[model samples]
Structure formats: C-alpha cells, structure tokens
Target: MKNKLSKLYKIFLAVGMVFSMCFNTLGMSVVNAYDPSVPKEFTRVKNIKYPEWWGRKIPSIASWSTYSCKYDGKWAFCLEAEKKTPASGKYPAQVIENNENVRKLLYYGFGGPAAYGEFAADADLKTAICPDDPLTNDDIKYLLTHIFLSGAYSGQWKGFDENLFNQTFGSNYGTNIMNIYRRIISLPDPGNGVSWEGNKSGNRALFKASYDKTNKQQVTNTVKLNGASSAEVNIPLASNVTIHIAGTSATQTGGTAKVYGGQSFYFTAPCQNSPSNFVSDNICGNGCERFTALAIHDGGAGTQAQGTWNMDPDDARLYLNIE
Candidate 1:
C-alpha cells in the first residue's frame, strides 16, 4: 500500500510541473487566457501600415471610428469618430492624416527630427485633398500647453484651437487671436439689424431699429429710399446709434429733429462728388441741433438740412437724419 501511494504522489507532481512549464513558456496563466469569441471594444491595428513620414501611428481603429489613445501619459478618447457610426451621425475625425499640426504633435510627443521631411510632405498632400479633421477640444487643450504653447511647433504648425490657443498663448503669442476676434466683430452684416424700405424721390422714408442683446448695443438702423412721397421714421431711444440711409436720391428736411441725447450718434449721407459723408452728431442737453427732414428737389437733387431744438428726455421717439 505504501509503494502504491508513493507512485501516485510522483504522478501528481509531474502533472503540476507540466502546468507550470505551460504557464512560464506561454507567458499566460489559465485565468488570463485570451478568448477569441469574446467581443472587444477595440482591436489592435495590423496589416495596414503608414509611411515613416506619417509621424504618428495610424490609429488601429477604422476611419470615422472612436477609440482612446495615450495623450500626455493619460488615456484620451476622441470626441467624434472619423466617420458616421450607428451611435453618432457623420462625426469628425480625431486625427487627420498628413495634417501639419497633427504631425507636429506626433513629433513633439513621439517622433524625431528625421521625420520632419515626411511631416511636411504629408501635410501638403492632406491640405490639398482632405477636409478639416480637427482634434477634440480636450486633446487640443493638452497639446496647446504641452506642445504648442511650449513652442515645439511654433513656426511649423499653424493649426490651433482659436479660443483655447488665444486664451493660453495670448500674452506670449502677442494676442493674435484677439486681433482675429476684433476683425470678425468689425465685419458688417447688412442683414443683421433692423431695416426699412421707402421712396426717397417721393420724400418717403422707412426706418427700423431694435435692441441687440448679444452686443449690448442697438441694432443698426437702415433706411431704404425709393422715389415715392415724403416719409418719416421714429425709433426708440438708444445711445451712440448709427443710421444708414441709401437710395438713388434722398435728402434730410425739416420736422421735430432730435440730434442730441445720451450719447453721440453717426449719420451717413449721400454727397454730390464723394460716395457718402459720415457726420458725427452729438447731444449736449435739451437744446441740441437736429436734422428734421430729407428731401429730393424737382430735378432729383438730394438735400440735407438741420435745425436747433430742445429735445425732451421723456420723448421715446428718435428721428431719422437721411438725405
């Protein structure tokens, strides 16, 4: 009985050794074995390859796909997919191919100087053929501080998150983003404010103005004059208002003209030789100069006239100065 028991013990020990060899050689334990049948959220990219010049690894997921990547030593996920997924409609790509900014990001994050030539070539190709595929906002924030604001791609990567880039590097980068914002604000949008249609030749004018909540200012008041009859416009009280009058031949004439109020105002009128004249009108007190009426003479000549009067602050209506 003792001999039989010893043999059984040896056999069990040999089985244990075989199991240990399998675990050590394969680098996998039974508990950690991979199962092909299980669903996976992401899979490693294989077979397809990118050129060395591409700078960064082409994401393993398909185009328009969503996945996570290590950014700044942390896992960062794409805000949108490269294309439309069932979960999301036509989403933007996380990393655009051949993008100079993206290439710079890769270089600063992982690549080296040897990849610069490839980055430039790929960027040119992508610019000519690809649509804008911007990075996620969070990703942009990370890179803006770590890569862009650090001056890693100063002259090379022009692409940046305007708001974030401006906010982060405005002091050091010379507030270029603020300048861009100012330019955008200065652009005129004719259709944006209150507008009117009237006949200038007929002495008739239509005017409209509304409060602009976004700018915390009065919307631009516009007058369109056509040859018809005498007309007038009354707008609500506003500060530093700008009135634009346009037509073939229009003129300002006499009536209850109020040029002065809380702040100065502007007038754009037609002149004989010049395209138009811009006049600044100020209001000092109750007694202020006012342009009452605009009239077109018998021969289609435009005339602008002004008179002095004390405008009551209680008055809710403001007159139009158009010629």
Candidate 2:
C-alpha cells in the first residue's frame, strides 16, 4: 500500500509539471506581486533552477521542493524557512501569491539558516571561515553588511584564515554599503528616528548613474562643461570621471577632487596658449565608485581654465568649480 501511494505521488507530480510547462509555452504563467508587508526589494521570483544539492543537503532542516522563480525579470532562486537537502529534479510548489511567509526567504530565514539556527541555539557562531549570527538588530546588520561586502568584493578574497578574514572583510566600507544595505533590507531606525550613523537623518548625496526603475537599466548621462566652473552632475558608477583644464598658464600644476572613502582625483592642467588646446586628468575606480560631492582645486597661480570637460558615454564626468 505504501509503494502504491508513492507511485501515485510521482504520477501526480509529473502531471503537474506537464501543466506548468504548457502554461509557460502559451506565455501564461502567473506572476504575483511582492507581499506588501515585506520590504519592496524582496520580490517574488519565478523559474529558479534548483541544484541537486538543495534537496540532498541537511534534509532534517528543510523539505526539498521545486518552484518557478523569477527576480527583476530574470530567473532567480528562493528558499523556505527550513533548510532542505537538494535533489536532481524539480518539484512543484504551491502558488505563493502575497504570502507573508515569503519574508522567511531572506538571508536570516533560509539563505543562512544553518548559521542563524546555530547562533540562536547558542550565542556562538558555528560556520567556519566567517560565520555570522543574525539575532539582534546589530547581528542582523552585521550579517547583511557582510553579504553586501562579500558580493561587492567577491574577487578580492584572500584566503580562509581567521586573520585573513579579518583583514579581508573587517574594514569600514562607509555609507556606500550602509545605504545600499538599507535600501535592500530597510533596516529599522535605532531610536528617536536616528540612523545607525547616530544622526537625525542618515542622508547623503549619492551621485548615481541615470537609472530607470521601470526597465531596470543603468542608463548613463552625458554632460558638457564648456568653461562652466560650477555645476551638478550624475554619471555611472562603473565608469571613470575625467576633468580637463586647458589654455596658457604660468606653469602646469596638479589639482585634486575629493570624492570620498579613499577616492580622490589629481588633475593636471595644461600650460598651453591655444584656446583649443586641452589637457585631461581623470580618476579610475573598481567600478562601484560613488561620490557624495565634488570639488575642483586650482592648479597654481596665473592659471586660466579653458577647454571643455565633456563626459562621454564611454567616460564618466563630475566636475565642480574650474577656478
């Protein structure tokens, strides 16, 4: 009788897959909106391909199942509250429209459940090579911040030593990562509406690329600084920002623009006489660069600012004050 029941379950699962495939072939799969209770960044994804390990590892923790998942118009993955071992095949999951339990799919809930559970079981980290326990607000912040930085600096991993972990991940990443984590996780205010930075409002100017939320494209913006001293500009984070100082001067000297967090620019103006002659200076970063503000310094005495500071699509631009 048990064998017969197991066979029947397999048959039903196969049939369900057939139906799901048919619906998808006809371009008629149900795409549900995200739950209002959770943060907006956590959207319901569909058609996430689960690996075999998902159903095979830690069977006691999670019940392995398969479901279609998509994220931001791309295929993605999802997890249940419990940790489950993975299998070789996909499984059909119930339609989870507007499900509040979906919040369990976050890092603390499923992604890092082993670490979370062990930490909760005892106030000690269990995972080797950088384990984090997401319990208190601070713990949660630490875990998410680590995730953000790990992803941001994935290629820069040194090794698996504890000291190396400290050296690799234990640096002040500043508000760039903080704001990004908050944007994604919506971390609660500490108290009295004060931010983690201990300020009334944790706000700062983020010179970001022209982004369109509707289509989710990092559209680049181009600006022409034709003898314009002071202006506001926005450009892509992955691109380089350049400034030009042209025309005759007493002697060519270098100037600096302070971006923030180890990002500064030293530009050299040309000491030429022609109006069309120009010299260029620029700063390059590891692609995730952002500037809270921009300021240009005068190279030296008797130096006149000329030429154009054109930030093309290929090259980024943010120049403020030519004098």
Candidate 3:
C-alpha cells in the first residue's frame, strides 16, 4: 500500500538486512556496517530483471484518508498526482518526455533506460536532484526512479513474512512509524512462472528511471486474489478508493471494531486494467483467517479484513484497504 518510501522497502524485503539493520526502538536508521571494501552504493543486485531501481526514493503528494473493519483497520494515506507540465517542454522535460522509456517509470514502480518506454542517461550528474531534493520536477522524476543503496533504519516501513526477519529482528517489528520508505538492493525473485521482481545481491543499488510530472500520465490498476483467501482488494491508477470501519467490520471483541496491532507486512494488489471500482464488505468471510492475520493483537491494530485504517498521533497505524 505504501510505495513512496522506496529505501525502506529494501529492509523489509531483503531477508539478509534483517540481521544487519542498525535501528533503534523508534525504528530510525543507524549505521550498522563499516566495511570499506564494500561500495556504499550497489553495483549488481541479483534476482530483479533490471538491477537499476535498487536504492532510490520516490516522492509523492498523497491525499489522506482512514477506514476500518471489525478487529482490524487502516489509517494510511495515498497520493494521486498527474504529470506537472512546465511551459518549457524542453531539456529535461522534453528530453525525458521524448524518451518513451521515461514513461515506463511512471507506469510501473520500476523503470530503466529502455524497459517500459523509460530511459536515463549516465551523465556527471552535475545538477542532479537526488535522494530527497525538494525542488524542480527534473530532479523529481530522475531521483524518484533511481534506487540507491542504504544501510537500514533511515526510514520506517512494513516488514513482511520472511524467515530472515524473525531470525534477525527477534520479535521486534511493525510499520507504526511515519515518514517510512523502502529501497531495493538485491533480492531474487522466485524461480516460478509467476514472474516476481527482486534483487538479492549483497549490496544496495538503484536504477535510472524518470517520470515527467508535466505529462500527467496515469497508472492503470487491477485486482484478483488467488485461491480461497479471506479477502480480495483492487488498486486503482488514480485516487478514489475508501475503506470504512464503523460500517460492517469488527472483531470477536464485538463491543466495537478496533484495529489489531502487529509487525510489518506487505500487501500487493493488481492494478486495474479497465475502469471499474472494486469493493469489499465485512472481513474475509470464512474461518476468520483474514481477521486473525490483521487483528490488532498482531500489532497492526487493524484487521486486514475490512480494509479499514485507524491511525492516531500516539501511534502510526497503516490501515491500507485497497483492491
């Protein structure tokens, strides 16, 4: 549900980092490794098709909203922005726009020089806006797609179901912090026909992808849960999805639905290929697998069932209800 924090994503996804991540109770970044032989930046991350988007931060302006279901809920935010076009339409914009490769980064989370109609050239980066620049769209698109290597804890993020996480963190997990981000280093995809994206090399890396905010190009969405699962979610290209908690969702705590809290988790829903709004009611209807998974007891504070999110300042809860 949260993608902007690209750097933070690497920590949660890469099982190895679970052992080396230098973090505090607050989940902030701390320098853990000090090997000069290793490059501060990633060179060749494995698993992912293009090891370009390994360690980069993508910027976004999300409109905030909240929703909840019985026993679990969500209080996450999202951004639906269009290409911010400048009058010039030359140089970076035109250069990036003219390059069909540039549009690839805008569509999918990953972008490279030629994949998906996007491109990034290797220049001296004399005026490059990167990592976290707050000016200019040129810097915005270029920096957003290029993933950079990071140590760990620089940001907050959700950790998913990986054995490395449990062995390394030792019962400490959760994405309850704000300003969280995820960066990809080297994580390998599964060797199945499903076609997954990952880079599992020992170093952090980034790809050269760009997006012309000026074009306002949109990303399409779709959703489909395989086999018999508790729930199904659908993501949209733009913004207009909502998850309601008070309506018809809750936990055995029947008193009233409250979000369950738990460790960091990943939720991936397909982007809609056509124009249609997918919706869900009640928690996953069945033996309660859905409720058990997202119950606040796990530290999530919201049931993954109803797609509701209830986050307050005291604690950061991500009620990511999409698809």
Candidate 4:
C-alpha cells in the first residue's frame, strides 16, 4: 500500500534535495563520501568494469524512432504525460551515475568510441549524451528502452527475452522502461563465481544471483534499495543466509531477515521499499524518500547455489524498476 507524503516530503520536492539518510535498526549507513578533487566529467569515473561486448559494434539509429526531450536533446521515444513531469527529474543523479548498466546504455547510444574513429580509451560519451538538466526516472526509462528496441530491431540483442519483455511492457509505451535490464543480466557470465541479474514484474523488482561452483561459493554484496515497499529474500541453498536492512537514525524502522538455506524472508515498507515505488513512495520521516542498504551473504558456508531477492538498484547488483 502507498503511504501519504508528509509535508517535509513536499518541501524537499520543491527544492530538489535529499534529506539526510539515517540508519535503520541495524545501525549501519552505507555512505558514499564525496571527493572534491576528482573531475566531475563522466570519463573520470574509475574502476567500472563494462561487459566485454561493449563498444564492439555501434548501433545504427537511422531507423530508430525518436522524440524531443524537454532538455533540448532528442531521445528515442516519448513518455506518457504523467511520467514526464518535473517531479520525475528529482530521482537522484548520484544513483544513476554509479550504475554500470546505465552507463553502458549511455555509451552505446552515443555510437561507441569506434563510431567516432577514436580509440575506446579516449571516447567520452557522457559529454555528448548526458543532458545538462538532472535526469528523471522517465528520462532513463525512455533512453534505455529506446536504445534497446532499436538494438533488438537491428538484431543486436540476440536471444532477447521476448516473453519477459512482452509480459512487462506489453504494447505500452509508458511501461517500456529499463529494457537494458534483461540484456545486462544475460551478458556472458562475468566468471566471478557468481553472476547478478535483475528484472521487474508488476510492483516488485527481482534479483538473481547465479553461482558457478568452479569459481567460488557464498558471494556477498551491499545492495541499495530505492522506493521499496517490501522485499523477499530466498536462499535456496542449504546454507545460512542473512539479510539486514539498516535503519533510519530517528525511527530505526529497519531489521534483519534470515533463511536457513532453502527458505524466504519478507518485510514491508518503512522497514521496506519496493522497486517501482522508490521515487513516488515517501516513508522516511525527514522526507528523504528512504533508500535502504541491504547486506546479503551466506555466512561463509561455501555453498554453490542460487539466491533470489526481490528488490531495487545499485552498481550492477540492483535494477530499479522505475515504471
């Protein structure tokens, strides 16, 4: 169920700022400390590992459908009126900047470095594609889906998840968001013992961690949850897995969930946030629009098995189903 927006939430909406995020009951806050010396340009982002297939071929946009973005740049498709509002723009640039999948879509849409005849190392797609205005959730949805459809049409996204796309989008332009999701997960295994992929179904965002026994077992990662209402973490293997939701400073509306290797744990909003509702749902007392950092791992049992969590975005670990 949706929670009422508090007055403070409305105020933050007006000024375009995030309220200070406090920890949940778990008493932990995952902070991205800002560094002033690093250049703000997209090219300056360091240590990102793009999929091997990136920049391999530049997609032809000649036949791709187009739309006029309010920011003066032309995008691939137009969004429904409700989703194109200025409010949508408030959904955090910091989140998008840190996402590897979003970055890939950006570079690919700009025709890759090869298209410019410059070496891959020198290509700066951000300067060319990232708009000066703050990016809205819809802006991301439009761009990613547009590029995805064009790529699919051009036969670039081979073995595409047709059923998944049809089930999620199903002849609706407004819902054609995050088409890059399935593609990202489907990429060749990262060979890291565990591979991560995420998808969206209705109101829930689904996350899958596939483990390869040859590499390693029991992978743990920090996950950031955006707009979550509730979540379910399922550890199908016979190991002890623990999921913790770090709480807010004032309320401590956070806790932990655990499953004995073959069970699932679930919780609701405030103590939760659901994927699609991140931008619209406001439960944080300071009107911060609560984003949770979830830490998940099998307590070093070294079990080679798959795990699933229905949640939202960060790095490549989460995919925000910002419908």
Query: TM-scores for all candidates?
Result: 0.16, 0.21, 0.15, 0.18
Q: Name the weakest run of 10 consecutive residues (lDDT summed) in model 4.
A: 303-312
What do the candidate models score in CA lDDT, each in turn? Answer: 0.27, 0.26, 0.22, 0.28
Off by over 4 Å in 1: 1-171, 192-196, 199-223, 226-323
lDDT of 3 by residue, 1-323 (tens): 22233554455557545644644445775342222222122111111111111112111212211111121111111011111111111111011113222122222212221212112343322132222333333232232332210112111112222343334334422121111113121221111011101221221111111222554322222212222222222222223222222233421211222221111112222233322322223322221121100101111223111111111221111112222
Model 1 residue 230 distance off true place after TM-score fit, in angstroms: 25
Error of 3 at 123 (Å): 77
Estimate, for each residue in 140-232, the C-alpha lDDT of model 1 and write its tens digit. 223222223123222322233345444543443324533422332243211111122432111223232334566544333444421112122
Give the candidates in order of lDDT, highest first: 4, 1, 2, 3
Distance from true location, Cα of 163 in model 4, Å: 16
Candidate 1's displacement at residue 67, Å, is 17
Q: What is the C-alpha RMSD of each candidate to the true structure, in Å?
A: 36.6, 27.0, 28.3, 22.2
User: Between the candidate structures 1 and 3, which one is better when assessed by lDDT?
Assistant: 1
* CA lDDT, candidate 3, residue 317: 12
Candidate 3 regions exceeding 4 Å error are 1-4, 15-217, 220-223, 228-323
lDDT of 2 by residue, 1-323 (tens): 01123455568659978987898799994432322122111123222222223223323312322232222222223122122212222222222233222222232222222224322335333232123322333333333323332332222111112343234345532343344334433421111110111111112111223334664433222222221122222212211223322232222222333232222222222222211212123332222121111111123233211100111122222222111
Order candidates by TM-score, high to low: 2, 4, 1, 3
List ranges where model 2 is wrong by over 4 Å: 1-62, 66-68, 74-261, 266-317
